[model samples]
Target: MTARDNRLHAFRPDLADARLEGEVSAERFVAGRPARVAAPVADVRRAPRPDAGLNTQLLCGDDVLVFDEAEGFAWLQAERDGYVGYVSAADLAPRAADPTHVVTAPRSFVYPGPDMKLPRVRALSLGSRVTVTGEAETRGTRYGLLPSGEAMVLQHLAPIGTVAEDFVSVAERLIDTPYLWGGSSAFGIDCSGLVQLSMHMAGRDVLRDSDMQAGALGTPLDPGPDHSALRRGDLVFWKGHVAIMTDAANMIHANGHTMTVAREGLREAIARIGYLYGGPTGFRRP
Candidate 1:
């Protein structure tokens, strides 16, 4: 684990994933068990303690490989993006069959039955994978039935292979979402979380952090100081922040300044954030 990123690798001083036995040093290794996120949102923490710093988040139905379960936390690696962290043990469940659809709405409610008047079960965020075992209808509204005996509006779900023509449009739908440090859902989100969620809906899964995204994700562009080269869908980056260009003149991001996902004039944003985080570190077109 010397050169491998701990955020994406399973390792600690006393233990490591069995898959890394020959490539990394550890006192012992174990091939972890498979599981899926049971909570609507599970905070992935840097350490096992309840107050440990949050590194990322996993949505309901997200798959994980659990390496250890102790202290009421599961040390695991997310299957979709390789993010490794500790999630509360209560938020995990035995692995389910493969999902067939993704939640397309920013947030969609799960109902006890196909009827809209019934009490709600919970809400699933956009990009959450769901296994649609069957379909039901009530009063002209279509619903996708899940294995848990819950129903989600079919209008809010897209078949697994569905893709968006414009990923920026996906981000636009989340305008004014409250900014959260490591939130993973539409209820709240961060700079990189916004990018990853929007891109996932567009069928382009990306890394979890601004730095990781800046280093990967797209073709690098030499946008000059004024950023005259930027256009729609281009990603602009600061040291620890990232934003998607809505157009040449505007961009959207979840920033602490506004504490919400908001659009800003490109020039104003550059100047305001530059005073703190310095100027844009890179530009990318995906």
Candidate 2:
């Protein structure tokens, strides 16, 4: 698909957000006020929507520092595990975050209904690759971030491929994964996740994050027939994302707004996500 800028913002709050379930411990949270505590514990959860400090997700356990109380969010550092995001006050646990966690296979569960239970989160198929960044406890179950940037239960999975072929083969499985923010699974994925998983399936260790990925591949070529002759298995990369080219003018990838794996007009998808959509890092193949 030709690269194009999608104006819509795909930054949906994590399922751990208060919309689904009451903010439980371990659900990332922020505070509207900075209430001084005698001493913070590693497992201390914050009160719902603390009206004082901003607890942004940081690389630490439940330990959070009060940044801006007016921001209605607190900048928090995870003491148990360091990964950060904004959490609303209503759900902030004034105590230690919970350890109930779940992870996704390779591709699974694009969207979980508001009423969906947690244990059933694993009903989807196991993905070949997994990354546990975010966590949430719904009802009595734990859900973690799927590679697709969604939420799912932990699971076991098999390999996708052995080398570059694996990237091409396994990616073929997500021909329709929807585009999602922070998504990295087949159920819903973003541009970067598609590239990362494709490479992972091939048994080729590549950087998982998007910006870092720009430097992970070998020297890139221009997106044209003259540039080493584009192949079906060649890689098409942009500033913050990548895709697999199935033809000289066609490619497959997950877009945030599109929210699905799709074959886009090669130059167009590239132009949209690359030149127009905060990308243009270029393409590469191994």
Candidate 3:
């Protein structure tokens, strides 16, 4: 059967076209268990090993469809982007509790107790979700209790439904964050990850990759030679890269060339990217 005909095609498209001799069926391998990320940050790996290549990351409260569990890994598909990979079984919880708050700062510490002097439980990246089960005040500082019973500064989090006025501003907050391929957290992010995370904070559902984003987001912009028509929030697309126009003259993106999120003159960026990847393929405005 063709790739599209297989029931598990989306989970493992590579095996769809392989010839099988016996009466083997894809359903024999499907587990179909629902799961959610329990850790502050869980790395999704290409293989079921601790040292395997990282494919992506899942933050707390992110949902996944667990297809199998073996050794210390759980093979699953991320709910947000449908990415198939293996996450540590320790990070996958059967409970799918709804999140009440999202981390608003670039990063925030989860304290063992409500006091600032207490040991930190973990650090959560921006956009990480958590369930607040209670509230407390210590030494004049207010904190929220996570479902795991850890305390985090309430001011560092916003209700899950909160949205930023400008997504570009959200992207700018991560100026010095290191670039990681397929990373979506503040610790490290890719070009499309920055776009997706920023747009998500601004209440827009953006695709995970640049190519998918180029086809899914915004209105097509017709720019004359030299791209003199770009404006704030405009999305410029390259063959496999993307950036946000901060204004008429500047653009921001997480580029491996820079090794971090940075702003550059639109003309300078155009010239630099043109030399590297043949200029932008298109422009779009959301």
lDDT of 3 by residue, 84-197 (tens): 678999997886568899999999999987888988878999988888989999989999997767899999999989999999999999999999987889999999989988
User: TM-score: which candidate is best?
Assistant: 1
lDDT tens digits, residue span 124-162, model 2? 322322344566666765556543355654332222232
What lDDT does candidate 1 reach at residue 44?
99
Per-residue lDDT tens digits of candidate 1, residues 1-286? 2358999889998899998898888999999899999888999999999999988999988999999999799999999999999999999999868889989999999998888899998998988888999999999999999987889999999998898888899999999999999987999999999999898888888999998998888999977667788899999999999999998889999999999999999889988988878988889998
In candidate 1, stretches whose alpha carbon ends up further than 4 angstroms from where it belongs are none
Candidate with better TM-score, 2 vs 3: 3
RMSD of each: 1.4, 13.5, 4.1
Of candidates 2 and 1, the better by lDDT: 1
